[model samples]
Target: MPIKSIKKARKLIREKRKCVNASQWFCQISLAFFLAAILTNQLAYAFFDIAFLGELSTALQQAKVVWNVLMYFIPGLLMILAATALVMAGINGVVAFCYKQQLASLKRGEG
Candidate 1:
């Protein structure tokens, strides 16, 4: 029946909306991660001139080494994660567009 088809179309529209929402969240999170990565990378570069390196205790020196390693490593990981999220967001947007087109065709009695 036409009513049944309408209900199904409505459901599809709801699903499309959900996908849009998820895509938006992924984009926002990706932006946040990208910003964090940039900040972390800048921090790594900014603190390289340790004038008091010789005055630090052994533990402090070890801590500095760990900090340097992590600062360099975490940004690369964050960038990768951000790229993944952006890709997911793009996929979701594409899915939502597909749902929208399907709903449109259903409205035209094409499916």
Candidate 2:
């Protein structure tokens, strides 16, 4: 993947977004959101635990209580994570389909 020469680097720069296509980028972003949402739930609890305490189990329980009360907007954070994941999956599927369509069009020289 490394540039073999300055010419190749210049060619890449000139290409800009001519590589992959926009729908592919959208699919990548949706996949990233899916991962981020999963991490966010775990990270919320871990953040509080890291900020406090000497005992692991006890510290995690305290963190959970604080997180639940503070993040009550979601009622249960797991529910939020699940909803976000579902949305992400739906988006990813749409974008992936669009990307495939774009590729097909490119092959047909419709652009």
**Evaluated with TM-score, which candidate comes out highest?**
1
Please give, for residues 1-111, the per-residue lDDT of candidate 1 as tens digits.
388898999899899999999999999999999999999898777775553345788888888888878888999999999999999999999999999999989988888
Off by over 4 Å in 1: 51-65
lDDT of each: 0.90, 0.55
- Specify the highest-lDDT model's number: 1
lDDT minimum window of 10 residues, candidate 2: 12-21
TM-scores of the candidates are 0.83, 0.34
Candidate 1 — worst ten consecutive residues by lDDT sum? 45-54
* Model 2, span 1-111: residue lDDT tens: 233444454544344333334435545655655566566656766766676556558767776677767654433554555566556556655655555565455446563
